[model samples]
Target: MRAFLPLIALATPLALGACGDPAPTYIDQAWIRLSPNKDTPSAGYFVAHGGDAATRLRGVLTDYALKVEMHESMSEGSGKGAMMTMKPLDSVDIPAKSTVAFAPGGKHLMLWGVNDTAISRGKMTLTFLLANGDRLLVDAIIQKPGADAPAPKADEHKDH
Candidate 1:
């Protein structure tokens, strides 16, 4: 066993190092679509990538907007008669090594009264609060409403 002592020491450190660190959660492709009507709330979308361990998205906060809330759209009925409804979400589950998208016609952020400073800068910083007590600050591109803007989908409405 004496001859194997040095080999064991070398292998032990490598094994411990491999198990020491886990991937961290992160957000990307964040953007917000401005509302033509000032009274209407603008919508925000992003993709959240889960870390090595599972966690929950508690909430999102931003200083640039007067209010920010997490919401999801759902269809109450089927076919042409289907009605789209939105409900506020307190938290969203994020599984390990998974990706959750906040896209149009699905989960999204509602922002009211976005400050002109952010609109002028064409970008804004949003804070993501996770259940693991990790607060991630991410920048989101701002898309202004204009002729060149992408047309809204049938399911996407201005009611929110």
Candidate 2:
């Protein structure tokens, strides 16, 4: 019995480690910059962390905005100095155990026709549609033009 105790204790930890649950997929550090001109579209940013299985971000839905779409910002020199363009993204892949950032000057969300109430509240609810049929609900802080977003660390997106 005493000899078997050591083996059982060693096996117990290994068993738990092998059967441990994978980290859940989630969104973090989400925020939206409302366009000062209501006519123009606003921008949103966030970081999506994948879990054990890889997933793709299909789109974002928000009742506050008339339309929300995923977009990427790219800069190119078309013989006219530097020009920036926004391209609609059909989907973005998030690798397992990896993080995908929706940052400015990179991949981001374009929010159009945001409701006054939602803007006034200073927060908005965004539903992230994943390829795996999972919807992630996140509340994003809304920032007005010239309003300072909480000081973001380097690499985190912050609206200027």
lDDT of 2 by residue, 1-160 (tens): 9999999999998999898776667887888988889899999999898888999999899999999999999988867798998899999999998889998789999998998898889899999999999999998989987676545557542321
Candidate 1: tens digits of C-alpha lDDT, residues 9-94: 99998999888668888887788999999899999998888889999999999999999999999999999999999999999998
**lDDT for every model?**
0.88, 0.87
**Model 2 worst lDDT run, 10 consecutive residues:** 151-160
Q: Which structure among the candidates has the greatest TM-score?
A: 1
| Cα-based lDDT at residue 93, candidate 2 | 96
TM-score of each: 0.84, 0.81
Clashes of each: 0, 0
Q: For all the candidates, what are their Cα RMSDs to the real structure?
A: 7.3, 4.8
